[model samples]
Target chain A: MPIETTDIARLAQILENSGVDTIEIEEPGLTLKLVVDTRPRIAASASPAAATAPAADHFVTAKADVAGHFRAAHPWQDKPFVAPGQRIEAGAMLGLVKIGLLYAPVVAPTAGIVDAVIAENGAMVGYGTPIVRILPHAPSNPLN
Target chain B: MIEILSVTGPASIQDLGRFDQYRFGVGTSGAMDDVALRAGNILLGNDENAAAVEIPMMPFRVRFDRNIAFALTGAAVAAEIAGRAIPPWWRSYARAGDILNIKAMSHGARSYLAVSGGIDVPMVLGSRSTQFRGEFGGLHGRPLRVGDILPCAASTAAIGELGIEPAGITLARPNAAADETIVRVIVAGEYDAFDATAQDLFWSSSWTITPQSNRYGYRLQGPAVKPKEPVEKRSHGIVPGVIQMPPNGQPIIQMRDAQTSGGYPKIATVIGADLWRVGQARLGGKLRFEQTAYSDALAAEDEMSAYLDRLRANMRLVEETRTCR
Candidate 1:
């Protein structure tokens, strides 16, 4: 049977009640992804949302949201979109994942300075593969 | 709705050309890159004949006055909104107050911008394409200029941003010379008038697109092709893709905005399937004509149809994935 809207609502409620930050259910053509964001922002495109988790000192790694061949620069462009040490704003594009003719952008999840580009150019990447490493802008308080 | 903030290059609203008005002495004025325009409309779930902004030159910028889902296809331009560069052949939702600036194009000659709801324009003669000669259709029947505010049909459908592989890249013929644009053609009514040597020269010599080329027609420069005797012909009905040779022996391929009738002798007609290729050929570029049979032209049309069919199916699949969540 196909999953109903009420079923999805119930699953979301359960996840919220259990204090789960995120829950993804992938079954054939269906995918139920719910992320509890701490801040308000436009999140993802048609591609799957990247696994954005903060590491040491608010450092976050941006990963590929879709599976494709990683392209540092667009096919028509000569220079890569992002460079190490370059300050990036949230939602900024770091690279592209070219799947056939479709180019799925690898976007920055948080405002930060580029530390390194993890995935090599032209490398075949799957969903959640790290593409760029960033040291996120330090929170003014660092504590709740 | 969006406000045209700037237009550094020529742009105008167009749909599929007006076909019914040719008998009334009106020419068809449609997207030069109809394939891109059609695919873009399909991506936005808009009508196939929905009007879009055809931008041939770049550095075009616009500001969204309201939230709208839009698609950009054709040349691979660096189109950025809110600092996010969307690829060509892509659709995305633009928030009110967001600005989309299309910088230099890197690939094809023209680009099309199709919004969620097609650009709202008064249709003249059953089409929204700009009739430049008649000055009747499309926003005042002229090229788009800066500070023009165009309304869009109201729509509220949820849109998922995506892109499609352009048919120009996938369905291209592989046998053509690497540097020259090739368009398939069939011998026309005046084919028999030309001598064998002249006919051979017409097919073998490379033709360069002159600077005078526009929506009216593409003026080609090549070796003079003349018939054995000067044949005067009465002006008769013509359509886009008719390659007519004038008294000077230079060929002119009529385009979307070509006149309904001309007295020029026709040497060949570009097949409908490959007309888009000729339309996208850049000025100052070279083009070669390849002879094709009627059956092969139909097969080419079928291939184009299949390409569009697959694109529609892919869009449906994307919609399904979005709703399944």
Candidate 2:
């Protein structure tokens, strides 16, 4: 039997009320799949991977949020995420800290030009250990 | 929901597999790399048996219609969502309207995509795995095509985005060479029928995964493994991992989609614990076999279970870190 437009609306309502994300129904000559929530993209929380470390004026330090072996690049790839003197946009990935088999990303919290990548590649690092120093971009800066 | 934009080769939904139904002539159709599927689900905070997309052909592209977290495992490939790089063996959130594109992998065969809450397909015969030949389970029991939208169940679990080390790399094999993939096997019932030369050649020669290979079976190209005499046998029940010697004399390893019964004589069976390594083995690559004892196979199984246990424990810690934040 074919489902009417009214039946689909009712199904969607029921799925939403049940707090479910999806439902699939099948019958003779008909198949239906309803997804209740499809909008409202989940944005990655503002650079949650790294902690902010204290630094001298005009510069900011990116720190490891988890204790692990800091890797400058993914194991399968050759290029690093960021390098010294590179212009880094806000929310860019700085590197990764591998904890056991899992690797947690290290994201930049603020936009700036990278001054130095302090964390040695493949070296053990503790939580909040300084990893990258960036000269913060400012309205008055000529390089902006 | 995620809609397929472009795809190559055969891509389908798979779970652990539908078992205990072989009497009905149904073969278990599941992820070629079962370990990758299991790990993908574990990484997504879903049940280990949750259904996932098995993409063997690369250059697959899809667009996410909902914001959901997904994990990729198996082959090492360069994948991206909305131009943002996604690492292999990693789980991350995909925003609505984001497109994920995976190019052909440099290594391994199949790649799995397990989303948060798992793929929500109508299950057939106690599984969501696709039976291509029978065409009953999964999405219409065939390969995914362009414009196919896959629905996912609700993501209720609190989990953090992360990547686990590939199990093939973490699990160690004794005296295995880096350039070769060595799979442990046990002598099948018809093994003794083969003469000493053929039996010795089985272990000594390098077997190439031929082009005729598919989900049903892998036709290996190596030394002729003919038995001393023609041992014609009646059709007998068979299972995946059984290595059968056909008339051509090359070994054919039955895979997940193989028929329930076959007429060929069996030489050896790849151990249950080591099948995943063979599953990830690249086509045209060289493979070697080692005959192992039963107890050692059990030990290998235990080691794999231990690695998965560590993954679960560490993933839970990722959630804890979020709560602490």
Candidate 3:
């Protein structure tokens, strides 16, 4: 039997609530991985004007909050936090900037598909530097 | 073999130490965390006293000039090779041109990087350790600089034969309390010269490692331990871990680079097994001394030797198993 879409949604919800970033489950003939980005982003309430801007409908640039070396993934992780063309939800983590012992996470402002990764891994980035570009997700039909 | 890329602060080549050189007025300057040095060496199948890089300051970077197996121990620092993370007290193989970056220490104060067959610096006084005061041994007897290329002893071990895993050996103090370290000390012959009140305060009070502390000695800040009366004496021979009470009444524990002789009265001596604790103690860290009998000190040394023996046996077994496969 194949896993249903509702089951994947539930797994994603569970992963988000558990405070873990990723989970993998393997059965006899199926394997599923659920990853939830928990990094904090610029609050939607404070950026209402920017969210409504005309450019927001298509491309949105995610900016860093601190000056440090940018890393697309944790040092031990093999894959980038958010890969290009990956569909990501609002508030999902995009990447990280490490300053000394502290790490600041970059998060998505709205649900979107990643268009490009602007900041190179291991490159030093300054505050408000654009790190990633995203294309806003199109609205789904209510009847569907 | 590795080439130094950038160094944040002082780093030196060290082994166990230059032994039997005290009569010539030569101090035994070696790795601050000797336990870490031994661990790194053993993990890489090098001689236990082989020369390795003692990194006191962090953000040290080096590029592997050739494929080799290496081990890192001590100071729980964040380490990476070509951007892939590796845990402390673990061994891994690196390809040529892979940059190994060691970040600031998270827990301890120093780290040791040991490669297979050890660093091949010429020895002086029968040791490869840097005598910083004399400026005679180990990479021109100075800290490593950017673009310095140090030779590594030749090894025939295959890179595929090395395993990546924790060596299951630890030299850290067991069950130590948070933010405070308990170091074991054996009271010296002149310990009784102090007043009863001062003696009581010595064991009861916590001492802070002052910023003045270095590889020479740990200048501690705590309650002063005054002798019963002023007494003059000639200078006598001393070694690392000797707790000397100078005229200032503050206790100074001589370290690896300390002078061979001292005129101050010795109150206590830290046992060899517990000296690593003092070495890993960060500046401004808290330390409390606990008096132990002479026999207990001997037992601690035996325990340390036995732990190393077990680690060596395990490493050999792993190597043999990998070769058979």
- Collision pairs in model 3: none
Worst 10 contiguous positions by lDDT, candidate 1 chain B:
B155-164
Candidate 1: give the clashing pairs: none
Candidate 2 wrongly placed segments (more than 4 Å):
A1-56, A142-144, B155-159, B174-179
Alpha carbon lDDT at B23, candidate 3 = 91
Assign candidate 3 its CAPRI class: incorrect
For B289-317, candidate 2 gives per-residue lDDT tens digits of 99999898898888888889999998888
Considering only chain B, report the TM-score of each candidate against the true chain B: 0.97, 0.96, 0.94
Kindly list the per-residue Cα lDDT of model 3 for residues A64-111, writing each as its tens digit. Answer: 765567888755345788888898877676887765423456778888
Pitting candidate 2 against candidate 3, the one with the higher DockQ is 2
What ranking of all candidate models by lDDT puts the best one first? 2, 1, 3
Question: How high is the lDDT of residue B51 in model 1?
Answer: 96
Native-structure RMSD, model 2 = 15.9
Prediction 3 TM-score vs. true: 0.68
| lDDT per residue as tens, model 2, A1-144 | 678998787566445433457878889777888877656545744554345433466788888777678899887778898888999877677888999888888878799999989888987765567788888788787586
Show the lowest summed lDDT stretch of 10 residues, model 3 chain B: B160-169
lDDT of 3 by residue, B154-176 (tens): 74354432222221223446756
